[model samples]
Target: MRSFVRVLLGLALVFAGTSHLTFARQEFRAQVPELVPIDEDTTVLASGVAEIGLGSALVLASRRRRLVGTVVALFFVAVFPGNIAQWLNRRDGFGLDSDEKRIARLFGQPLLVAAALWSTRGGSRQRS
Candidate 1:
């Protein structure tokens, strides 16, 4: 079950990252935090690259799953602020135009964090 969840998460990240690089690039820009110094396109592209790298790592590096999961968890936490910024700024994107949807989303991030950690043991040294 855990492995399945981890794979699901990995695939989701890849899909999202691909969206960031392609069709949904503009929509994703709406989620970028206002205070971030980088240009919106740069933020999107950089994050897309990070997501792909992290996702690919999660999927392809089974032996490195501990490290990859930790990175994925931290990456989710890092990008969380963008979720908040979306709500606070009331910027509509990804169909989260309503404040209610955005608020609910804010609470879902920790679950992603926990899932990553629990699934991969999050940096723990594996018993060989």
Candidate 2:
């Protein structure tokens, strides 16, 4: 079950990353925080690359799966501020136009973090 969820999350990340580099580039830009030092487009592109690398690690890493998961969770945590910025600044992206929708989207970040950790945890053996 964990493996299944991990793979699904990995694939989802890959797809999202691909969208960041392509069709959804503009949408992702809306999520970039104004305080980010880099240009919005560059931030999006770099994050897209990061997502791809992390997603691939989630799918492929075995001996270090827990480490990969930790990194993935950290990545999610790292991006959370951008989500908060979007909500606070009323920036629309990924169809989260309303304040309510944006607020609701914020709730999903923790779940992603939890999922990343849970899915990569060692099963019934020893916790890493």
Candidate 3:
């Protein structure tokens, strides 16, 4: 069950990353805070690349599953402010148009973090 959830999370990230690079680029831009130093497009692109890499690691890095999970959780944590900014600034993205929807979405992020950690738990180190 845990592995299944992890794979699902991985696939979701990959899909989101692809969206960031393509069709949903503009939507994702809504999450970029005005305070961000870099261009919004550049930030989106970089985050897309990162999501793809982290997602791939979650799916494929068996020996280092714990490490991958930790990084993925941290990644989720790192991006959380964007979610907050979107809500605070009244920026709509990913169909989260209303303040209610955006706030609900904010609550979901922690579950993603927990999923990443829970799915990768247990198991002794298998020497590389």
lDDT of 1 by residue, 29-124 (tens): 999998999899999999999988887777776677777888899999999999999999999998998999999999999999998878787335
What tens digits encode model 3's per-residue C-alpha lDDT throughout 5-108?
88999989998999999999999999998889999999999999999898888888788788889999999999999999999999978889899999999999
C-alpha lDDT of all candidate models, in order: 0.88, 0.93, 0.90
RMSD of 3: 1.5
Estimate TM-scores for all models.
0.93, 0.95, 0.95
Model 1 clashes, total count? 0
Count of clashes, each model: 0, 0, 0
Q: Model 1, which residues run further than 4 Å from truth?
A: 122-128
The TM-score measured for candidate 3 stands at 0.95
Task: Tell me the TM-score of model 1.
Answer: 0.93
Which number leads on lDDT?
2
Candidate 1 pairs with clashing backbones: none
